[model samples]
Target: MVETADLTNHFLIAMPQLTDPNFSQTVTYICEHSREGALGIVINRPLDLRLREILAHMDLEADDAAVAELPVYLGGPVQTDRGFIVHPGTERWESTMEVTDGISVTSSRDILGAIARGRGPQRMLVALGYAGWASGQLEREIAENAWLSGPADPEILFELPHGARWSAAAARLGVDLTLISGQAGHG
Candidate 1:
């Protein structure tokens, strides 16, 4: 049997027809994928909440005005109260996992404390919750034409405006989302 390709460091762009409010038109960055399951963060769903507010809620004061104002993303519907952070893979943190050569996801409170004190990763995207798929579930979804999978680009992941990530991620695969039909009937 051919081994299925692993999709770590990839993006899952919701298909145009995927109207589920939680995932509609979103680009999710895959952090880890295995036979057991998958974990990802929605890169384009910035909530009204900001990092500074989260810090204050945690009883930490912001040491840098700019970092505090950074937008916090609604990573996904799972574990909505938890926090997750995506940043350049740099420095050792209490709970940091290097998802790619230059990308890391930190979930420990120390990293957040560091961020509040202006000592966190220079570039980071704060998020709450994460998208998850049970074993074989994500593969099935892709096979069902619910998403477009492509290599995750850091520029689109961390640099672009939140609203641009959806199309930008799909563009990396040379697939124009606008051209994809919203109707989902097999020909």
Candidate 2:
């Protein structure tokens, strides 16, 4: 059984059998979950795009002098033009979704500006694009063993190194992810 409404702020760890190139070894943070569908950001993959580049393209300024360094992550394949930032919960900007207890996702340009100005949330991950599933879609995948869902930790979403996030997140569930076989069949 799946906990649908409570999926928001949780992490979905891709099962080894998820052959979709886009989701292999992925750790996604659920940003929204409603009857409309589910939306998330992939936390484990980093792309060549940088936060500075994204901000510049959005016509936002990055005050290198005041702003701390930023890291860009590969959110997902959907809406590559759009950007999403996962951060610690804060009230400075709007357009945020509580992804977990202490984590939030911000897409407003104002938040980007604040980050550039060094007034942003204490922790964050800037990502372009996001993973989405239509109503009943994600649930179907999970039932097929395409993913393992679990609660998310603030550190796992915002602080763990990108390459290690998948494994780390799986470990939180007491599962040895490497042992998960990708071959799928009806049990």
Going through the candidates in the order shown, the clash numbers are 0, 2
- Clash pairs, model 2 backbone: 9-99, 17-182
Task: Provide the overall lDDT of each model, using Cα atoms, as 2-decimal numbers.
Answer: 0.90, 0.82
* TM-score, per-candidate, Cα-based: 0.94, 0.88
lDDT score, candidate 1, position 39: 92
For candidate 2, which ten residues in a row score worst on lDDT?
62-71
Best by TM-score: 1
Best by lDDT: 1
**TM-score of candidate 2 versus the correct structure, residues matched by position:** 0.88
Relative to the true structure, candidate 1 reaches a TM of 0.94
Candidate 2 lDDT at 47 equals: 85
